[model samples]
Target: MSVTRTIPYLTIPSTSLKRGFYIGFDTDTLTTTNELGTQTIDAMAHQHHTSFLFNANELYVNEDPENGGRPPRVNENGRWVPPVYRDGFLPQAPGRMFRWNNGRIEYAGSNYQWFGGQGLTYPNNETLQHYSSTTLFWCNEFTQFQMMEADATTIDIATSDFPYNRWYPLTFRYERTLSRVSASVEEQYLAGRDGAWIAQLGLQAYRHRRNRPTEGLAGNLATIVALVAFSCTDDDTLYNVLINNLAWRGQLRVYDAEHGRRPERGVVSNIYLDPENPNGSTYDALRHLEWTDGPIIY
Candidate 1:
């Protein structure tokens, strides 16, 4: 049997300068066994979660007097007038412009043409281009999408047969911490005024178990993976970022209808830029931490 559930739409708080949200899985009820042959469960046990942070300031609205306000528009003479700046900052240039049509927001234009006809240019006079029209493409969108795709994404587990083929409630929550970290705090940390270089931290874990046991075996094996991603929305995505991951393979010894056994073993890997390392190397200090079982007994 298969079941599906959609978490109600969670609104990222508009009041938050740095809008963000989190999706997490709870597997505390799932049973597991340690080397001692005892069963145990914890909130972090067999859990999977992910947090997403986006710059709300990047979102812009068009000016339409018919809708609410007058926006900059092109005149009959073919001269371009810029739209009203949001929060005193002009909408990101060379990107798709969204507008309201009959009370519905929709894509209006792409590859904005500024008064200069060359689109918007940066301080260095280089042209700013937005490659995606349907999706916003600021701050390594492709990389973020790729990372999510490579991992056990939220969508993947929600649709999978893991968690004992039973239904479980998914939770979504919003937070503003991603944009709230002050620049002074970052400077202090990077300058070594603070003991730690971590500005913000997020953790996620994933686990997968086969439905049926192999022939001649009492039970099946489960695969688990966890990730720790660092940096907040305040950090520049073009520069530095780090992700630490731990993977584990475990055995599920099901004795009968009600009793089962679980034992796990795992490894860790990391990805980061040289400058992003808090330990003054390409690897973060967390990467050095490890736990392992000496040898497997049959």
Candidate 2:
């Protein structure tokens, strides 16, 4: 008879965020032993912090030479450089801006100068109002399954028994303000490299109203929030062992007083592993949250 045993491998942190927020993931190593001997593997965890002014509103000026040309350019070190003009202005809206700083992706914004007294230059307020935010937490861990010989002479391990394509549970929290509102969360699964949705997960919807914590002379002073949690493991057939091109896409919709039912934002995260070799994997884990899409009510 063959015997099987299970072991706890990793744990992902629970995260919470206000309108403007930040989150990160880091890796660690662990070693475990069984009848087949001991092995080491990499584990990952998440952390969250308040991003005061990191991802503030972005700014873009009309770069068309036909539209009075472009502004003077300067590098990060304040060095002057030749101005590069674009055919048209980039979209000026609530969206995530990615920049290559050092070796990692850094969130940054464009700068615009404001002049005050005595020809002095001052920084203009370019911060945009956050409409809604989504927070997601998940984990990607490595596990090994092997078979051993009773006499410690010959052993065999089949890769087919390995859970190469494990589905990590997804927990999403959404928040928006202005008035009492209703929200819904949808999950999408992308099948192959072509990036087509093979199936759509069921959606869960709820309504929330702001509640005040302290007694005030005014009205309520609380923030409305909603939480949605589900596990992809419920559908075992959706788990693919050979190809690891599986992706999870989330869309949050909220009822707006002016816009009715509209999509606040959509997020895409997935895991990729070489089908033939599971050791080579690219885990596109969730890094941060942004309220970059939605109607601006300023």
Candidate 3:
């Protein structure tokens, strides 16, 4: 018989939480060693921050005549030097964002995040089973399945089982299913490539500068520190993964329905997630919580 193992990825908010997890603080007083500190930050964040100020979602801009109609910002082929970072943020707070509470996918991000504005009645006796990982109930099935597709099902599947594709067996995993952060994110961060642990593109950021806890309008600003490692890799790489995932879960993005999207149900069982669903229907491992949504159109 094969032994199945399970590991918990969600760390409860507390004073003793490790660097692996980040909890948001609305207060001004903050203390941490990993607060973007003196170490360099990825240039992607700077580009994104600047674009956000200009109300532009893309980095593409008109060629500057100073450089013969091709500025350094524009690449050799006249393409935006760095791509976009399109993933949304899920504030790591209680009842504020998507979470795994008491072993179930709780949608408190908002009514829109779950069902959307009023007038749509809730599904009668709805419960969904297709969470990404049975061991880690918080994960969404669509993103997990997308990751599986990207990795060719070799990374998310268990090490004990044989994968048909050429791949590296993961040392950190939860049961047969994979943890998005530990399994894939960690592997990518530590890949020993140009951008893994060190800044490859030469975009260095300082915690003291970006956060400016003492400089911003509201003194003591507790900024939302990025918690996921996959994002720290490279904006282009992150956007690439996000773009691919969109084919499967595009409308589910919040920005299309709302603005500023991290994605709520993208390509989820968006139409519905009931026992009758052919793909993301209910299973024995799932709790009683069904989602009936309208087609999110731009």
Candidate 4:
């Protein structure tokens, strides 16, 4: 006589059942691993949990309008002209703005001024070609800059003159995009001030020539090699599914030179080869597998 064994399949329903969202998976022996949790999550459900949160201030429209109204005066074009303010002072007038064809600032209006600091051959009267100021720039002042000339040296940014004649200002930094809903936004995270990782999904692999590190290749190779030799390799493969701000589920595997890529095609069968030594390492073979409706959620 022969006996038959049956397995249980689970259908995961979305929060909004009317939307017709679902995912189906089959179990090996009707036994669920503790890592999967009692209730497995659905991909759509996880997406819904994270979609509602976003920041609004990142856009320019959310900023407050500039205060201080325009000044009063009639220009040739029949428009009310305003005096421009400079450094900390504005022209003396009933209204705040005034016009000037002078030094560095051209027109004065309210709390600001404009300057056209281009081309010039000073009349025999002007002494210096460049002018620099502590608070602002003018045609007549000079502001000094520091440069880094040598390989190993500490540079001070506060000094006016270059400590080393050959160095120039260079910057190295990273940035990331963030979404918020008017609240819960911070400068550090958005600017990538420290070592912050931007949120992203998918697998990343680095491939380099066995003998040459200078010129290396990346992508597809690492995945193909790992998948084919999974049995021989220690489980160093890492897979993650993100739902909401938290990582609801994840799997981690590691591979070193000692344990190499295994020749296999399926994931589940290879993972279940040695039941007696569930936690011990084993060499197994895999066939093929597929996912249709949604991401594999544990």
CA RMSD per model (angstroms): 27.6, 25.8, 25.3, 29.4
Best by TM-score: 2
List the candidates' TM-scores in order: 0.17, 0.18, 0.17, 0.12
Model 1 spans with C-alpha error above 4 angstroms = 1-28, 31-44, 53-87, 93-181, 184-189, 192-298
Off by over 4 Å in 4: 1-249, 253-257, 262-289, 293-298
lDDT of 1 by residue, 80-116 (tens): 3222222212233222222211112222233322223
Off by over 4 Å in 2: 1-27, 41-57, 63-85, 90-283, 287-298
Q: How much lDDT does each candidate structure score?
A: 0.20, 0.21, 0.21, 0.19
lDDT of 4 by residue, 1-298 (tens): 1111222454555443444433344332222224345433323312211010000000001111233322332336553221122111222111111111110111122232112221121233222222111110111111111112221112222332454322222111111211110111232112221111111111111111122211111111112112222223222212111111122221112222232211111111101111222222122111111111111111
Estimate the TM-score for candidate 2: 0.18
Q: Global lDDT for candidate 1?
A: 0.20
Residue pair clashes in candidate 1:
63-71
Query: lDDT for model 3, on a 0 to 1 scale?
Result: 0.21
Q: Please provide the root mean square deviation of candidate 3 (C-alpha atoms, Å).
A: 25.3
Report backbone clashes per prediction. Answer: 1, 1, 7, 35
Ranking by lDDT: 2, 3, 1, 4
* TM-score order of candidates, top first: 2, 3, 1, 4
Residues 214-265, candidate 3: write the lDDT tens digits: 1101000000101111122323332332343331131222211111212221
TM-score of model 4 vs. true structure: 0.12
